[model samples]
Target: MSTSLAEHVDALYSAVERAGPDAFQAALEGIVEATQRSEPAEVSAALERLEPMLARIPLGMGPDLAQVAGAMTDFGGDPASVLATLVERAAGAMEQAARFAELHRAAGLALPDPGDFDAVGETRDRFTAAVQVRGLAGEEEAEDLLQAWYCGDSWVQPVLFMNQRRDVRRALPQRARLLNGVRATREYLGTAGWLEGLLLVLDDEPLIVLDRGFAGTGRGFRVTIGGIGDNFQLHTMLAAALIGHHLPGRAPAPAEVAAATDGPDLTPEGGIRGSWNLVDHGGKWIWNEGRPSDIPHLDGVRVVVLEPEPYQRSWNAGRAYPHMAPLLRIDEPLSPQEAAAWLSRCTTSS
Candidate 1:
């Protein structure tokens, strides 16, 4: 049998540790060549092996590795396969910052002019260097830097959600409370009442509804903020939102409000639903290059189910709504006792 992809990954890391960039390049090329030679089964298995390896590699090598990953995809049947692998497997803020840049490039979106100095990248590098020198105290600075630069621009909000979920789950202090909050939110929002439920969301803070001075009737406008492939992601985000709202000193991590609000499945009926929020009820839906905020106005219900207009650019997947302003403006954290009682009441209510 041919050398397994996992074995090649082992060799690749060995090259990175024992040698340097050149050796890493050579080993990456070898993996690419192996990919080109392998059958579909082998190629699929390779992607599986390559995903977790994203964490083990040097964080600095992300851009280069993403390039090589793109090259590896060239050898595969679909280009998005490798890109999706990197995106699906990225584990941390830094790793996501690097890989998401590649994802943006692969999407064929406009790239910044090469002559322009990447002030953001330079600033991040400076922060990283300082963290190395200053040690623990510098962590706050690094976090701030990551939030300012990476969280919104380079990395998507869902990536941030996944990262936070993984981090909090690892060191989750109060598991019962977290799950209880999730179940309470889910139970309270059972079929309808998301409008009032949303009020309770973010510690009873009300979402600001902006009036654009337009109203009509047609297929409702839906803005997809993040990808939700399964119920687990849905529950994780729901849980994260509760953690941010209910728990004191454990507020949602910086840049996490987007995930907390828009990451989970917006099921007014409660089930394994997708992540599409009604941004426009009867008017033109604005699609800005920046984040999308499309909280539906539940005032009009003529037919109950509105039709959707034929939309182009459906290929834009895995987009995130990070640092969204209107959602962040609402903030009045609920007390833990209130949270517990609310959960208890919701659980015990008819």
Candidate 2:
């Protein structure tokens, strides 16, 4: 087995398989080189190697391409089935990656530079391991857990329940903020990300506001405005929250809550504006992050807004999106009926 493309493929997979505790650097470099070349046989061989671990790769970033391609091949028996599987599984990986980052930062670690994920590309191996790396999951369990993550925003429930390590799953709610973070983390908030935007349909109002990240544990537990300081705060909150979330504990003490507040938000956009919209899409609730105009058929649907939660101190840039322009004012966890009544009773213009 000379160092053909196939060898590179194997080497890349081996890197993803994690040759050593810190072999990530070498594995990443090999992956970069492997993607630059075109060797179908080697790539095929590499794909075969990944065939077994295919279920587990998305628990980290090293296997986006591989997962999709592998699904295509495996789905040869039932193409539609694999297509559906890949779509949902990809979504789960997206959210889990975010949760992983939330935990990573909570652990007092710096995020890897974007350059670290540059090796990701169109090919199988390159795609397989691009956006994530190996996390705590093994092959057999990874597929189910990862898929469950994307299936719903409350994915943390299943992930937390499935894994015995409360310490790891506890990180699912790092920052208690909206799903906004690095590429690996932020990507899950929309598109490939699970949990659609929040929607509020108001009567006599010009806009039907929507906030994509409203109340899903899929969003981190600790929220940030984009600074190490915020993560530090979240770190403290996580310690307490994780304990309460996982173990039997009371709410934050008065002293602890009072001491929790830090200085004013340093990020731009002047902090939060209002509570997010929880739109009803069919029976499922979508945290709509789109513009009111996006749902043109809905009358007077002028704009969509990302309503802030005054009770929450974490940072959320969801409002910055121009599409989420129309703001809807409502209390926390407004029920669908309440939102409709508030909208109907609206006496003033949006």
Candidate 3:
């Protein structure tokens, strides 16, 4: 804990009585002054021990504080200044809440940026060149209709500051905990536990928040497109990008969103049958891999799709799809002998 940002946090504790925007600045200066006076041997020894220990554990993230300190310390830079910037950015994230001080004093100090990349430029290039976004609803479909469009996929996980009240997500206990690399934290803590534990775990790094909700802008809210499903902004454009369809450049207005065309609508029977259909409609819609496809449910057997890359499937699909879900359910019905027999027969001969 001492190797982490505990000292800078103590400065924040000391400086809060001082008041205002300058308080953060003062706390920053206080940290620099304090660290500069500490015995250089103590700091160097701590960093040397921390380096190899971090290597063994593998947070699987870009860099931990010890790594940062090593680079800065070895390369002639200041650890105090580096920590001040991290605290400042984190403070900006928690600025809105009444609980800011308590949270800041606790977990707010260790969060890191999820790492930045040039998203807009990447979106433009990837979408424009994708051959995957072509037409596929029989020959009657116009070949030139979608000849030039973006068919890229997007996986957005919005990270909110721990200060905000996530009451909406908290109230419901049913959303899926879609576990992938991006959502690993949410999965490890479990979504409900994350909501409950937010205030308690402030010092933990990689300060982004994830939910069972969606990839969108502004606390995950945006203009509603009737066909695009819930959570507008990013999902709208991303859904458009994924299937490569209408209003693909940006999301339309709340009024315009309703009128804008989306992907293919289901027949009286549920499910989409073509590439063009997949692009226009939204929600956790699964891509039908070439040809009209439906996996039949067999007695005593259940099928589940786990963690698709672009994440068009809902984590909450335990409720099932409209028509087919009624027939299929999840369970472990086979006894150990039964399971072994099935596995042996399936693998050994045929």
Candidate 4:
């Protein structure tokens, strides 16, 4: 709705006299530009203009258009209708699947299911009754919390984005165990709607995008765990951190993460245990008594180990790891010294 965006869109509209490869390229560029400027409304406007031309677009450009639409959805644009048009225009199953994936993720932007809202009531009851629950500020604070729940359920979510040299499917044992642990934790958490993902080449950079819905309340807790060396290590640490943030929980101290790494994996069927297998290393707690030191999920829930070789190749080829756009970002790349320090932290024993 901004005047500048209006002007820009007008320019693009004027330039696209007919539907052709050049027109598709121009529209794609417009969407990308609007997205880069963080103008969601403009992105929507640009896509609206392009949607009518979907039928006329060359079959070869279907994938290209779908790719930009996917990126637009990530950046807050509503491209559902446009994506639907592209999906129908797709020439094959692979093309349809690609377009559908973007459509599915965009669907996540809608309000969460009514059942999901039930958690807010539980949170309210517990929060109201606890006289000394952590961060309790009485009735006003409770109201704020309720309002947050009311605003929407499909808000910010956690995702692990990686660019590496190895396929995620063919992970090293350590990374495999960590991946399994994460999937098991999600299964145990009963978050059925969580997404299982595949490797993708996005924006000319290979990426592994794994994401799912996480409650807003669960995210405000500070991440006390540190000492990360690789994507695998970071993912495992986040699992431990999230577990600690849940009820009857507290964030794992840095020392605990340090201790947990290189430790035995958390295997259920009498398999090898390693860092993925979380233990209470007895670190100090910022909130409650902290996560129980006992091993968890021994029943052995089914887990999906995401092997990320596509991204691994990109990383090994000297490409920087892709940022988790619009949600998480690295303002700058790690320098040699900084990278070495992380490696040192990972290598050093507790």
Candidate 5:
């Protein structure tokens, strides 16, 4: 006698429980194959023949058979097409089952309990929001930020230091404060996880943070923002200029880093020579009084040290140089034009 639909489903579920997701998929494949082999009339006759048998079995196979039958009809009596649809659906179900199984296995292997897995979805949403900000800001600004903060030679050492000293989330918040004008305290409110905290940076400086986020890879808060200010702008501007010069199709330059660094050096007239030192790293020149000053000569002007750094070194190993040194001394206070020109030259050189 033909096996009842209810009996088949009972066996299918039993196989699923005993042999896992793979067996469940195989059972689905078997059902599809059975459907494909029988003619429509023959399949109908078999269903009718097994109706009584189906009623006798305890498992709920009635709905499954009916659904399969209905699907066959929907496919315009193409049993093969119906089988294909069934296989596709079965594959999707098997995938879900496998995922759940893996999740369960992971739960068993120490660490956190499997409490609803809602956080994964929530994290994805936050990542999407962060990405959305990047989309809203155009590419040029994004590239500028990335090159300045994330890429190039000088970024490596500072990035390592920041990573060691600060938590990723906290550092990110500070960076947001500087770049986006958002307060660090405001950005960190009720932040739960690292990913969420990183997203909070975007919440403050959406344009700046988001732009850089796009040009990066990895998961779980990979972008570093803390030391971006010192060098990122210069690198970004230079990269843009290089691209503009080299690539015909790329976007125009937004702004240049030279604007920040290149300005006239103001010193006393008749070339005041004093010893100066490289006091700070932010490209500021400072010098101290009481020292023989041999500064670089240009345009009948000599550079003097305005601020002092007693322990300093110049290119000349034996020659004593100003601790806080100046590079140029313009007659009188430097005019805006002279200052601009001098700054332009310094910027171009440095």
Candidate 6:
């Protein structure tokens, strides 16, 4: 017989051992009655007891139980009903285990030293060294480094870096996508609600990085950030966006605003004309590289935007400025009026 069959038998025997003969017999009877009458509740109750029993057995037993479960459910309740349901559930668990096992096997995986993830001490030292080599300093320095790395000529290096670091690569992408999704949702809702509890971001690119943070309730926002990235510059920007501001709360940056507003006018051939190049919408022009076909289009593509509430507040504090003179510029946050003016300029330029 197949190994699966043996596993099923073993699981059933184990269940019998744990529940005793009397409970097992009663469960079997319940399965039979439920199968015969097509009563879901009876079957569910029977399965509940049976499931715990099966959990004690090795994963290999799953396929056998799954088969039995499927057969019993199909057989419609009888003495065979319990066996059938068990088979079905077992099959599912076995399949999942098989997949997980295969993934680990393919990579020849092994555990890393605990020191690799030491965030407060050695990890910080490593980060400091990296930043120093890049000649960047201070808190905002990290963000600047990341932006330069991603948007600069050496962007490919970071991508490769993430790909090579197995531990960090596995988790970074997941975390990034999750953060983006949550930000988008909050922006759509138009509320300053907090994302309470622990949220983790994982990416599978080159570096397997994990980012953890907490969102605040009420008007205050609290966030803690940490992660490994292929490029310090790209990761810094990502961290800022993830922790500094909630999505949709902030206006686009000057360059992004320019692109969004002006994009509709620029044609593929260069000058604005009636027949715009559909390709231009999808193309990207790297600094001096001209237009590249590989770059995807953003025209009409929906994206989430995040703004700093504190920045907005600062801008508003300067509301008393005389309208006649050029609005007194401040380094702090922009108020609603200042934000509007900035947006208006972007719109007009576009």
Identify the candidate with maximal TM-score.
1
Candidate 3: which pairs clash?
107-202, 107-203, 159-209, 243-279, 262-280, 263-280, 263-281, 284-312
Top candidate, metric lDDT: 1
| Model 2 worst lDDT run, 10 consecutive residues | 220-229
Query: TM-score for each prediction?
Result: 0.33, 0.26, 0.17, 0.31, 0.16, 0.19
Model 3: how far residue 326 lies from native, Å: 22
Poorly placed runs, candidate 3 (over 4 Å): 1-4, 26-168, 171-350
lDDT of 1 by residue, 22-60 (tens): 887777777776777777666666655555555455334
Candidate 3: 10-residue stretch with minimal lDDT: 148-157
- Cα lDDT over the full model 6: 0.28
For model 2 the TM-score comes to 0.26
Off by over 4 Å in 6: 1-36, 66-350
Q: How accurate is candidate 4 locally (lDDT)?
A: 0.34
What overall lDDT, based on C-alpha atoms, would model 3 receive against the true structure?
0.26
Better of 2 and 4 by TM-score: 4
- lDDT of all predictions, in order shown? 0.36, 0.34, 0.26, 0.34, 0.29, 0.28
Q: Candidate 1, which ten residues in sequence have the lowest lDDT sum?
A: 211-220
lDDT of 4 by residue, 85-105 (tens): 543332122222222222323
The runs of at least 3 residues in candidate 5 whose Cα sits more than 4 Å from the true structure, single-residue gaps closed, are: 1-10, 41-70, 74-350
Error of 2 at 62 (Å): 3.4
Question: After TM-score superposition, what is the CA distance of residue 83 in candidate 2 from its true location, in Å?
Answer: 6.3
